[model samples]
Target chain A: MKPIQVALIGLGTVGCGVYQTLHIHKQRLEIQLGAPVELTTVVIENPDKHMKIAEKTTISTDISDILYNPEIDVVFEAINGKEPAFTYLKQCIQAGKHVVTANKEMFAAHGRELKELAQKNEVQIGYDATTAGGIPIIQTISQLFRANQIQQVQAILNGTSNYILTQMRDHQLPFSTALKQAQKWGYAEADPTNDIEGYDAFYKLMILSDLIFDRQPDQKNIRHSGITGITDEAIEKAQQDGKRIKHIASIKYDETGNLTAEIEPIAVPKEHPLYAVEGVDNAIHLKADIVGDITLTGPGAGAFPTASAMVEDLCLILSKQSAPIPVS
Target chain B: MKPIQVALIGLGTVGCGVYQTLHIHKQRLEIQLGAPVELTTVVIENPDKHMKIAEKTTISTDISDILYNPEIDVVFEAINGKEPAFTYLKQCIQAGKHVVTANKEMFAAHGRELKELAQKNEVQIGYDATTAGGIPIIQTISQLFRANQIQQVQAILNGTSNYILTQMRDHQLPFSTALKQAQKWGYAEADPTNDIEGYDAFYKLMILSDLIFDRQPDQKNIRHSGITGITDEAIEKAQQDGKRIKHIASIKYDETGNLTAEIEPIAVPKEHPLYAVEGVDNAIHLKADIVGDITLTGPGAGAFPTASAMVEDLCLILSKQSAPIPVS
Candidate 1:
């Protein structure tokens, strides 16, 4: 009945959003979850720079400061890195603490092990923010697609690349200009290589693969390409041919039950579900046996949207709910 | 751990599909659910006249047969109409059995009492099939959008109407021909009044209203106009204006917090998410604060699609998980 004594692993954009949204919607959170989700501690490298905004939240330069605290019911891994997020999450699971994370990279590499560990500890590790930020696609897959054979998952899962390509096609702008515009609009990072080169989508694909396929996707087997070389001329030509150029990341299970994936630029017909999906938005279109096909689209990355997913996970943990264990 | 006992209340198109889908995907269901989900009894109006497809499931002629059997853990209410399906579900809930129904009409009319009754019994009553079939839009609202207030929900929720409108617009066919084509494609019922008149969508709106708004939306207050009035000339004019006619059902919560709903044709721009959504395809676009705006697309209605939603509910029940109890 008490508030979830929580620790945040970073003080970055999403961490700031998590802190801000939780503060802004404090009363609503208490009513919705039947408990207050308090961010008791935040681990940051530069406490001096972020202290003005995160004054109320207890800032720490040490991980052990929060990890050793018995009052922390959950830890949110908001930091965008691999080694420490993975290590901290493992420790949390071992300590029987529930975890809610926005770290797609960490989940992409080690989700199956993390899921198993969470089960062993009888806790939950929810990564809704990892796929489509705040879209609830994770819960949709776990809850709604539970009874169907999820044959294929295809998505435009990266927002930055999408913004570039959509602007090129719709506004007749070049990719570089679009990228700069996205950065100006706060949709792209200062160094947008991960998004432009399809690495962000690759990370998302790995996370979904873990949730759906129940195994880490073999990195060597996945066919990968980026939108770096996709030019304005190509976009114009595709548009002239009545086609839309989209960065599509798709994983398909063959009749033999073998999973194969591709992340590349493709010409989608005008009527495809992913065709209408434009701008800095993410869309996932799935083909399941029972449901025929369902597509979910939303902001794949943002401060509040990403934070919203983590907060949703905190609610799930308090509800003591876990996704239906994946079949295969 | 015994299997959850089930009593299917109807064996019509969706009922038959549910039974068949359960049997066909029994292994997948077991693997996904970490156990098997058995269909113990099926309620049929007439075993002699109705085909015997599900050989293992027991067929019943009377409603009391299932209602009296306390061993049934859940009741699948697939039968429509006000008399049997509605009455039977009320009795089942009164008897403390969990329910997963595909009957949208019952939910639209009498769901307020039923939802409260289920909560009183500390059980779940899921009707994911009632809204978007396999598209998983219902769960998205109840779970994903719980923390955020939705500004508007605009959707192509009815596949029959969408198919008719799409054929009329794309092929330049007359209304009668397009209607015939929809029937031929199994998108429309023999009596297409429910779809063409927009009553089916109206009922779905009521269900969504309850799930999102936590109150039964008054159909009297809603502005209703179906695809029947969308003429070929209108479609031509829309195309000339670089737009397409789409039957959009929308409910908007205003700045003052008043809820208003409408079902009518909209001339959606080509750049819009709903523009490329064609044929029997259906899409729901949600405008919200946190996630900016998100859209989900798929078959809004089908034996398989609706059956898949039922299966998803079964997983939710079997797995013991719930969250984002919306109306926030």
Candidate 2:
């Protein structure tokens, strides 16, 4: 088997993670994949600063270097947010290349359009790293639970929010104190509004709802709330009642198959599986017709874990395995 | 695509579960697979007595009915023990037919040989139902975590054993008393020796070891212990120490890459992830280099959950997706 050419579209936290992983695990990957997964080019904003790790690979600011490179079988999009990242991915698909992305914002905004484009081009589009980081929730829903009707999806999606809530509950810290601690720990961004305001989890819930309900979630109608409203009094009250407050993102299908999606801070009892999940960890609990409730918990972020998901998608694409076909 | 034909080798607990699930979820599966999954024949020991749910399918006592049939695309083995189930699975592989099984015993005994045979014959062999019931641990290890070198696997493989331990720990019941309760609740078999003596966990650990280590486990030398020896005093002592006594099956690879496999009742601290996994639920925590630690918890056993795994395997096979290529 010939080598499978690959390229990365970012040199940020996740991009560097992917490059380091691919470089360190090159031999192991070659042996497992029966071919080399070569990192051919890396597109970054500043190529000069990132030239240390770009020894044998091309460091470019031009995304066209990847788009026009027919040998690059798969393009990994690790750049955050939409814009040129989304535009570059669209061109990559149009150029007949498989794509694996860690961009939740892009998928949340234009997932259906991108999916349709990939299908039209007969190329694969994998975004397992987009949701729950390393938990593989997307693959679980698409492949493992394909036979069952997924009636409900309850998840702790935003690790930063959960971490803040956990800190407040455990140390009796106020919301602002917990938020500052989370930022110090690098779990939260400098501007943590997206996580604190429920937008981050909202994107993930939309992606999950789209997969389970087989339609784009009505984002305007989603019942969204956040941890900004959670106070020390509410936390203490829930604790007194033998419950812990968690930022939960959930979707449910009623008897008539109507979908209701929400993201809010809820007090979960000790018996609930998500009650014990703490600190920068993500968990997804799905209730399907056949399997009842199953939960998956793991590190929701970091380069290697997210890289773990990206490489798995590459393997699936290399093996010619298609993504799980969704049902309405 | 044409309808994919399938056969079942037993109509016992898991077999009946598969039948009822397939009957009920036929349309959903068809839509998901883009092809109908048809149940062609059911081979059972006592066919005459099991005619209630055998309405639309052919019932036969002959094993050759499926093995010799050219149209049967896949064979589902739900039978117990290792005799004809093993032989029939071998024949099915030899006949170039895919085989999906819930038989852990057969796999533990002859999994490497069967896997090689399947690869040689260029047919798929799926046994997700054999380990951790509906949790999809096998698929997760093989597909999702293929990029990581798994350092350790800690799991509650035997649900009956775990349930008994939970009962003893929570209610202070004696071993025999808790065993009786487990049996009454249909969580344990009439002869619970296999579960109590650590044989059930041993088999599952062996399977997991093969997947992670890419080598067959040495079952005879494995440090095997069970919950039968867990005394009420010990459980109470552990509880006082803020720990829970759980029947844990674990495999670890050290710095020198030496493999250590064991199954025993260990007192896990409250902070440990598997400590919260209680009752008949099963949980597996994998410590890998890339992903850190990831845990999955779900129904470990039952007709429906086990059937959910079998059906997932069927869909994978029907889609012509080959099994994950094992690491050398």
Candidate 3:
């Protein structure tokens, strides 16, 4: 069989990994999948940007360069946050190209519309990497709980915040020092607003809500808080109290329409799943009415983890599986 | 759109939960999925058996009641052990019905042929519940690491054995007493050959091998040991050393092939991710080239968790998503 040609938007960290991953494991992936699933084009900010790649994967700088061409059946959007990510994604769906993204920001804000658009266009949109970067939290919740009532979802969704908190807990360093350490280790951003302010986790939670609950928080209703309030003293206090400070994002709903959701640093016992989860790791805990509680932990970010998530989505796109059957 | 029609092959614990789950979450599932996924056909040993909603569904004694019918798009097989369960699943796949099963024994023995058969039939065959009930380990590794190499898979896959060990650790009780208690709680089986003998965990490892590496082990090549060899003195010694006794299943591959693969009881330090996991819980720790180390935990068995896993497979089947470039 012929390979399924793919077009990627934005050759950033994750985009670069996608290219490298496909290139490195091309033969193995082909052997298992029964044929080659190729990356035909990579749409990046600049075609001459520093990237590790072989000569085979053709690169492009414009979305039109790939989108207008009829050869690309799927497009992976790694560009994140607001605007064009949403607009470009919609264009992909409208063009009947299956999409898989590691962009939590775009999905958290615009997932509902994207889902509707994909369904309308009979294409699939995947956000598995949006939360737990290659941990399959989205797939687990969406697939595993399809027959059950999802009551709650709680997660350690931000790797940068977790890395900082882990440093504070281990070294008894102040938040600023820990944050600096995280930056030094490349876990945090230079600006770090989205990650440190809990917006990153909130965005992850929002996308999870859309996928698992098929409903999302109202623009203003999500009760979000961040890890900025965490201090070295707090981490020490938590340890003294036999707990660990974990940045958790959670959403809960009852029989009524009342929804309570938040992303904040919570004091968890050492034995709690999230407490055992350390470093730049991510985890999702699902409390379903029927499925019970399920937790998934893994690398919440990085080039390989996030790009790997998109690749997983690519597999799903290849399968051409339909959406969940509505329980009516 | 009408709900996807479901047929249950076994009316045991999970079957009852699947029924109750579908019934209890009717409204929520409908709201989220935008359509109803219904349990229209149920295949069982006897229609007269006491089951939740036994009277409501089209409960029948033969597979023809669901498998031969064109309307039944999905078949959830919840039976354990071998024999009829394997044959029934084969019939379902051959008849072009998408299959979701929790029968680890059947899967361990037949997954390769089953995957090939499903593809030939142009359908899906998923066993998310087969290994860890609700932990979603298979899907976690299969879809999440779609872009990375699965360096290794380590799991405490059997909840029954874990519960027994945990009781011994916490209460300093004899293994026999803990085993009795676990049996009373229905965590372990009457024979206990599969779990105590490490067969269950071994089979689960096989499934993971299929998902992450697409490689199946020759039965003779798999090293299998059981929890039976773990003594009370060993447990006490480990606890004195701030360690714990845990059953582990592991598979690692290198350039030559499987570097190491085995299932056995082991001593784990208090700080290891597997150490803190206790009770009727299952945890799978994954080490991938991309995502790093991610550990997932949840109830290993129960009516709801397994059904939740099957439901997850249903969601995957519905979504019809495959890996971008298939790793397994």
lDDT at position A15, candidate 3: 79
Best by TM-score: 2
| lDDT (Cα, tens digit) per residue for candidate 3, span A107-191 | 8778889989987887788888777886877766655555666788878988898888888988889999989888888899899
Model 1 gets an lDDT of 0.81
Look at candidate 1 and give me any clashing residue pairs. none
Clashing pairs in 2: none
Query: Whose lDDT is greatest here?
Result: 2
- Report, for all candidates in order, the number of backbone clashes: 0, 0, 22
- Candidate 2, lDDT over the whole model: 0.87
DockQ of 1: 0.50
Place model 3 in a CAPRI quality band: acceptable
Q: Find the 10 residues in a row with the least total lDDT in model 1 chain B.
A: B319-328
Query: Candidate 3, overall lDDT?
Result: 0.78
Worst 10 residues of 3 chain B by lDDT: B319-328
Cα deviation of A309, candidate 3, in Å: 1.1
The residue-by-residue lDDT of candidate 2 on B1-328, one tens digit each, is 7877899999889999999898899898889778787899899998777847656678899988888888888899999998889999999999888899999998988888999998888788899999999889998787677778888899999899889988998789999999999999899999998999999888888888887887755656478888888889999999999999999998887576578888999999978989999999999998988878899999999999999999988876666543322221
Best by DockQ: 1
Worst 10 residues of 2 chain A by lDDT: A319-328
Instruction: For model 2, report DockQ.
Output: 0.47
lDDT of each: 0.81, 0.87, 0.78
